[model samples]
Target: MTKLFCILDGHSTPFSVVVSPDDTVDDLKKAIKKEKEPEFDYIPADKLNLWHVSIVIGDDEDEKTITLSEHPDAKKLHATSEISEVFGSAPAKKTIHVIVQRPSQGSSAGTSSQVNSK
Candidate 1:
């Protein structure tokens, strides 16, 4: 099984989840939704975007907190991909490897017209 520490995007605290090598990324998402419970009650498992990332201390010397790496955009994990294939066969330990990004509530679909008013 693979143990991954995931944190909600924009939040610092990390949570843990375990999955078998046979599990898919979608399976991981479902597990995260279950782990988060009421916070994700309104959100579907498929809506939760998972990013394969590493945690690093912020540049600010005074603020000693971990933040997600600059890999979110390029590291979005695909739902159908197998966990093992994506993460390799090694078991993770004490490392925050995934970043969970909740879906945005607001849509920019209808805002395009406003920008085109110029």
Candidate 2:
């Protein structure tokens, strides 16, 4: 499983979710909704689009956005993009986990470091 301490709050929400290597960004969004957990009800995955996704590797949160859908699936997107490749297989059980935060403005440009332990 591809573990990530997802900073699922970009639009005034905060939460985490587990995903697999074969899962697409779209699926990731759907998951936030499909899980049916009220805790993350604010993250409505039904409308998760490419623009809603942001990725950061290691200590970088550059607010970069990629066309994940263009690659067909998450695997392909991971292979083609450096950001996806790095975080695609981050180690688990680390005391200092990563906070993969989505852009807060539906479009953001800050990479400020944030703590996301899992």
Candidate 3:
């Protein structure tokens, strides 16, 4: 099993999960949700978006930068794909490799409730 460090988008701290190379991205999502617990209980695993990113440290010592949707290298992993297929046969350890993004609120139909008044 390999430990993958993942940071939730918009949050600085990262969490880690140990998974096998054969595990699919969907499996990882489930694991992430389990690890995150109450903080993410309302969000389904399938609704979370995972991005492979390379974090760059800015010139300022306190600043860490990451580009997801806007960056070309940020590859969005498919739910069905195996960990090995995406991270290569041997993946690195002790580093943040995945960025977790929650589904945008109200992005899905029927997600938002509107009150119609007379």
Best candidate (score: TM-score)? 3
Per-residue alpha-carbon lDDT of model 1 for 1-118, expressed as tens digits?
Answer: 8888788876767788999989999999999999998777777788788988755434342233444454534388999999998888884555678888877757322222224455
Model 3 gets an lDDT of 0.77
Best by lDDT: 3
TM-scores, one per candidate: 0.75, 0.37, 0.77
lDDT values, one for every candidate: 0.76, 0.42, 0.77
Per-residue lDDT for 4-117 in model 3, tens only?
A: 878887676677887899999999999999999877777878988999875643345223544355556778889999988887765665456899888888656223344688
In candidate 2, position 78 carries an lDDT of 25
- The predicted structure with the larger lDDT, 1 or 2, is 1
lDDT of 2: 0.42
RMSD of each: 7.1, 12.3, 4.5
